[model samples]
Structure formats: C-alpha cells, structure tokens
Target: MKKGLKTLLIIIAVILVITLPIISSYNNLVSLEQKVDQSASNIDTNLQRRSDLIPNLVNTVKGYAAHEEEIFTDIAEARSKLAGATNVSEQADADSELSNALSRLLVVVEKYPDLKANENFIALSDELAGTENRIAIARQDYNKIATEYNTKRRKFPTTIIASIFNFEEKPLYKADQGATEVPKVDFAD
Candidate 1:
C-alpha cells in the first residue's frame, strides 16, 4: 500500500510539472491576443476620429462648391464602407477606398483656391492627416504583436495548446495598391 501511494504521488507531480508550462504558454498567447486587440482598437479610434471630421470637411467644401455631387457621393459611400467594416481585413479594404475618395476630393479642392484657403478646411485637413499618422502607427504596432502571437501559436507544444483553446490566427493590415509609389513633391513655381 505504501509503494502504491508513492507511485501515485510521483504521477501527480509529473503531471503538474508538464501542465505548468502548458498553462504558462496559454497565458502568454492570451496576453498577446489582448495586446493585438487593444492596438486594433487604437487604430479604430483614430479612424473614427477621421470619419467624424469628414462631415465638417464635406459641408465646408459644399459651401464653396455645391456642384461637386459625384465627389461627395463617393466620399459618403467610402465612409459607409468604413463604418460597416467588421474586422482588420475589411477595414483595410474600406480604408483604401476612402483614401481614394479623399484624394479625389482634394483634387476638386485644387480647382477652387477659395476652398483651399478656407481656415476650416485647412484645419480639418491637418487634423485628418495627423489622425492618419496615428492610424499607421497603431497598425504597425498591431502587426508586430500579431506576428509574435502567430509565431508562438504555431510553435511546437504551444501549437497543441492553442488548437485546443481555439486561439485562431489574427489578420494583418496589408498595404493598399500603389501605396509604395513615391509622390512627386515638386516645390517649383
């Protein structure tokens, strides 16, 4: 009976020795996932800020150029796409569309010096630019965390734990087409 009890205690200890690492790995994955989520939320917040500013910008421009209906419609549709996005992939797609629409709107503005000079439009433009920077930074941070988490999830031992817990892979923000093209910043008058 004493021999049997000793064997049982050894078995229990062996189980714990193995189970502890699994628990620690699982916890690290969970923390990494949470970090990715928080970073995504940061991006969402900035995008929302940019979206919220669009109305003021659109209306201010409308006051100067009411006939530019198509641009306004395009901008509205892009904003809608962004609003309806459910995840990082969807948001990236919509974000690309919204950027295109905003670019077109800017081109339209170039036709009207008065609109370009409008203080409200200028302020809104600067604010939107800053928010875009913040979004880029947040997305970079998210991608880094996601890559680390994905690596850990796929690694041996942890892979088994991750699968059992259903810890799926997170998506990364892919750059839009033509995003790599350098803009020609000519200062020549």
Candidate 2:
C-alpha cells in the first residue's frame, strides 16, 4: 500500500512538471495582451489631447480667416467624429479624416500671412504638432506589442493554448490613405 501511494505521488509530480511550462506561457501571453491594450489606450489619450487642441486652433484660424468657414466646419465635423468613435478601427478612420481636414486648414492658413504670423495660431499649431508626434509613438508601441503577442500566441504549442483559451487577434493601426504618395514639388514652376 505504501509503494502504491508513493507511485501516485510521483505521477502527480510528473504531471506538474509537464504542465508548468504551459502555465508559464499562458501567463506570459496574458501579460503581453494587457500591454498591447495599455499601449492602445495611450494612443487614444494622445489623440484626445490633439482633439482638445483643435478647437483653439480652429478658433484662432477663424479669427484671422473668417471667410474660410467651410474648412472650419469640416474640421469641427471631423473632430466630433473622432470624439464619438467607440473602437480602434473607428478611431483610426476618424483620425485620418481629422488629419486630412487639418492639412486643408493649414493650406488655408498659408494663404493668409497675417494668420501665419499670429502668436496664438503659432502656439496652437506647435501644440497640435507635438500631440501628433506623441500619437504616432503610441500607435507604434501598440502595434509592436500587439505583434509580439500575436506571434507568440500563434506559434506551435502556444497556438493550441491560445485556441483553448480563446485568445483573439488584434487589428493593426493602418495609415491614412494617400500617406504613401510622394509630393510633386516643382521649384521651376
């Protein structure tokens, strides 16, 4: 009877030895998933910061270029879309629209030397640019973390574990349309 009890104890120990690595992998995957989520949240925070800066920017521009009401309206609409977005994909789309609108607004600003020279507009533009940089960094970090988590979860034995645990794949942050296009600058013109 003592020998039988000893054999049972040994079997339990062997099972633990076999399962420990799998347990460790599961924990690591969870950690990576959380990191990805946190990074995505950081991106949203930065985007929100940029959105908050938009009104002042729009107002300052309005003060100078009051005739350019349509551009200001477009910016306001895009900013609202961004603020109302509930998910990452929606946020990405809205952000792209807002960025395009801002680019158009900048073009409008270029037409007015007085607006460009305004101290308030300059400060707001500087703040918006800095916020955009932060948003880019945050997006990159999120994509990196998501990629690592995805790769690890999809590899070999972890794939089985991920399937059993129902780990979902994350979507990547996509760049805006026309972002890859090279500018046509003709100094001769």
Q: Largest lDDT belongs to which candidate?
A: 1
Whole-structure CA lDDT of model 1 = 0.91
How many residue pairs of model 1 clash at the backbone? 0
In order, candidate lDDTs are 0.91, 0.90
The CA-based lDDT of model 2 is what? Answer: 0.90
User: Candidate 2: where is the Cα deviation over 4 Å?
Assistant: 184-189
Please give, for residues 1-189, the per-residue lDDT of candidate 2 as tens digits: 699999999999999998997898899889999999899899989998999999999888888889989999899999899989988899999999999899889888887899898898889999988999999999999999999999999998889889989988888898877889985644341
* Residue lDDT tens for model 1, 23-140: 9999999999999899899989989998999999999889888999999999999999999999888999998999889887887788789988889999999998898899889989
Which 10 consecutive residues of model 1 have the lowest summed lDDT? 180-189
